[model samples]
Target: MNKFELVFIPGPGIGHLASTVELANVLVSRDDRLSVTVLAIKLPNDIKTTTERIQSLSASFEGKSIRFIVLPELPFPNQSSEPPPLMLQAFLESHKPHVREIVTNLIHDSNRLVGFVIDMFCTSMINVANEFKVPCYLFYTSNAGFLDFSFHLQELYNQNNSTAEQLQNSNVELALPSFINPIPNKAIPPFLFDKDMAAWFHDNTKRFRSEVKGILINTFVEMEPQIVKWMSNGSSKIPKVYTVGPILQLKSIGVTQSNNALNGADILKWLDDQPPASVVFLCFGSKGSFDEDQVLEIARALERSEVRFLWSLRQPPPKGKFEEPSNYANINDVLPEGFLNRTADIGRVIGWAPQIEILSHPATGGFISHCGWNSTLESVWHGVPMATWPLYAEQQFNAFEMVVELGLAVELTLDYVKDFHIGRSRIVSAEEIESGIRKLMGDSGNEIRKKIKVKGEESRKSMMEGGSSFNSLRHFIDDALTNLQEGNY
Candidate 1:
């Protein structure tokens, strides 16, 4: 039996890199004959911190069947001037030659290269996998619902021969089976509306559904059985898709920054003093932020709801500018007048909170979240129900799935973004935010909590030996081995 190395090409972000590395860890731990090398592309703004975090994760996985090769930072002269999605695309495009070199050397050294696993953003790397006659698998860092929608949206456009302008202009709700509710026209991500971006997404979805060997989603069968079932059985377009996830190896990998001022001990201690399931943990994802007015509205909402809360806030980026983690600032300057003083007993506002550790706290009964896929999984893993407030990306779809399909969350308007370019979303008024807060943390939230608790138990059980997620991993390994032995990859 020969050992195999799977080359993983992760997009430039902590979220993408962490999930991919964790997946690699699980794959190697499950099969002793497997190893992985992550080709990490460094983004211009995140080079320093991303490097440090990856170095830390690499150290923790030391002596294990995992290693990392950080590709040099791409020389993007206009990095400071471009948006993140565009910047990330440019970085990945520039690093192709480097990735090709690494993959070629591994093969030349006679390493049994079983497959090439790529993050969703790095779908273009399928070409590299094809060039070397290796199978390519997409490691989706989000839920199966998002993946299903992306595939369906692509097919919808392809079948209709609809232009992006027509799709954007139409008021038609997408009738996707993955969602119990139809996706509102406005709730659709901007990428699907822009001609060039839609083309890029369609191209990738085409490759993923037809050309890619498999898709590894970061969700469990129990958490999203409907969508998972649809992808595995109902959809003929989607290739073999596996739910080998709730792949949270961040703790084992120790991926957090050690220098954060938000002391985990103090936060946990406060939670310890609170009644069980009494506190609502509020956090947007890493890049999530609100403007000054929005921050004021949030403060007012929290104050009105009178719920015990813990908020980890990042300063809003400048108009039309992107801000990195290193740029996080205190919230006192932007919060409403005397807001901190009034809510002192009810809430703790910090620059950054250790999210995983916080969510695991006993006092955290409800979560007010941006509905980022990572945050959604983390909250579910801890049995915390959510008040879904999505900011951007596929988060709106994730929110819809949680509230409608999965019956796990309360919604804060899915049409929150009225305009993407001008950042002119309908401001979630303080009253509406307060209502959502009350609904999630109050007795009305009991059903949602009950549902999430059951799913959380299922998540834990699925990760155990012979469990759904564990078996899914084993099945994927078996397929890879068969492909290798048959000389089909």
Candidate 2:
């Protein structure tokens, strides 16, 4: 009998887990020839606030018999603070033994084990696979644009801030339309600006190039063709890359993820009533938090735009009149006061939303987003035009690619320069916001919207029966299994 197994190793957050679990389901649904086990590493003590915080995706992994190898883990910071120093390096050193042991002990017979699927952060797990001499693939849930940016970080020591300055300072141009610099560097996370982040990024890019065997990105071909091309053969010694995604389609297999810990029913119902191309959907990924002033600016801009919208406001809750955003009750009160009253008739402000469902609804015209890769892909899958407000990480790159390269979305007014003393804190004003809204909600966005709708169709096509994503997935399984069957295991 032939068999295959994947070790689902996700990083320290819900986003990673969400992507991992969803992908795992995709792989499983494809055929009975494969099974997967999850290695859920917990963040200790710090997230003891609630059991819910601790097990972000444990319920999804339950009773599958694929085994949940819960490793006793470290405590990461909440929303703020740098990861513990040398986190990537330290995490590798600490988890290497556990990864090796779990493979050796819990996975039962070695003859049955076919391959390892590790997370991007779990590079050390690749080493364990090397020790075991099985093929290993690195899975990243972020956008291909972000991955493309990460791949270039290897040249940062030599590269300048041209990408950053242009994208952030109200300059949006695709450096290479044939290539996907999906988001701009400016909108990337401040971590990329930190000395620590720079160093770690440099090291990881080098490591990924040298060490990994294959790269599995959770995106589709039509979404970022340039990125897919670059990853497949861009740099020296990088592994084969695969683009297979919008894996949310796998939910049809009857695997349901628990609702995220927020309310979004109103957003969904409101969307249900609006006509197609009429309502704008606004959301900052769960990760984005803004000061009250910033929140007010965003809301005022939306109000001024006079567009019907469903805004998911997730700022840290305020206290008294004006409290520091960093000091919040439950992290949901960051919106400016009475601003909702001004737009109450036109907009619905909620604490959290069913973003994918909302995006899929016929009523959602365009999205005002922070451009997290998952959100980016979700919007693309739905053919929704975007007003890109990239807050951090590969968002800037995603924004750039969307507006300039793909011509599917518009990058709204936002400049993020890490440590520039001047103009580093610029917020897109209400007027610019309104204009962007009008563009996406009006005739100006129609052409872009139609193009993206076609692109989204292509994305789905890429994952259909004989499509690129589907074929790549099929080959990954067959190739891994053939290697195992040939006694390479």
Candidate 3:
């Protein structure tokens, strides 16, 4: 009869926030005694869309026990000398006091504060949870494989006392428990090559092992059975992990509010006209975009492949500016001349994709993605096979997992690093893109296509009652209640 409350602190990105909200929704829906209050953080680059998305989510949960509280946005710090990752870390750290204030007021209201479900990047909030004498659970917005890799990397770093330069320079293949084969040096994320970012992740992984009660990963057991088993049974240092996913936002969560609704409608209508399993959908993650040269290569490949396609081509934010990539005012300006007219019969290029809707369509057969964890899960859930083109972050590692470990996707390239710090590591040529498209859409992709279809059904089954993810969610809830009853918090 006692009611319990969980506070969810999501990271700044839309992907992180969306998955966290979905998890919160699931928790509250599973038990009426449970309630969730999401402490939303505004994206640093774009506040308007962030606020609008939060508002939309709040509207969707109207009258539910889930509540959203947008945190006060802080001004960008004057740490120009620091790397962007470190700067973002500091920005999140600055919210500690604000979090403490909100939690204090919640307790004063007689709410039974059970735990703080913080995003992976917001591990610093664990300190705030400790101060309030509540258990902290990390909502890992990524897959278990990535989490396992992080722990392994941290172990290696501590054991060797190695520098970023040393690790990058060495041509060593890491035999990690997460992957079936040894991960080559190039496949490792480029961020690990930077001293500051590597150190930041090292510290974060330590906190994950030593501080949190459990990590609730946005992945299912069937997706990464070996790595999930390794985290739960093989390693003592790893915290208790609950695989309760694929946690996805099936609804359009207001990100597309900025885009024209008619455009979204027309895109879907176009998809309806295509033959079943014919169109290969290409959308990088929200921040995923390319320069003129890369765009031209993709345009050329789409034209050559002659595959029905929907390409979400975004214009990268201006250098040194902290903003989301905007839609091209005239996409033709950056694309090859007459490319649109030439491919008018075979493809359609747009911006700001309605990904879930598109993938759910019968016409969508393949995905060319940036391998962001959310996008990966969505693709799997919808039974659309992917051709991996990882742009940054842990995406390269994710690409490796899909292509090498799970055999669920075709590989375009894994080690493509396109960010302000390093720029494009290498442009994927039109020939390579065309080949990948052929493999994804042609007969070459039949095996992977069949595999993803089965996995998609399994993904859905996992979320149903008595299924793996459902049972995992129940276990997580029971553990939280047990902690409360034992006064462990």
Q: Using Cα atoms with residue i matched to residue i, what is each candidate's TM-score against the true structure?
A: 0.94, 0.82, 0.97
Which of the predicted structures, 1 or 2, would earn the higher lDDT when compared with the native?
Answer: 1
Ranking by lDDT: 3, 1, 2
lDDT of each: 0.80, 0.66, 0.88
Q: lDDT winner between 1 and 3, please give it.
A: 3
Model 2 TM-score, all chains together = 0.82
lDDT score, candidate 2: 0.66
Model 1 misplaced stretches (Cα beyond 4 Å): 77-84, 169-171, 250-261, 325-330, 418-422
Q: Per-residue lDDT tens digits of candidate 3, residues 214-314?
A: 98999999999888888888454787899999999998866453232337778889888999999999999889989888998998899988899999989
Q: What is the lDDT of candidate 1?
A: 0.80
Over 181-269, each residue of candidate 1 has an lDDT whose tens digit, in order, gives 77776667765676666776777778788778988889999988877888888445678988998988547234343222546677777
After superposition on all C-alphas, the RMSD of every candidate to the true structure, in Å, is 2.4, 5.3, 1.5
Error of 2 at 124 (Å): 2.7
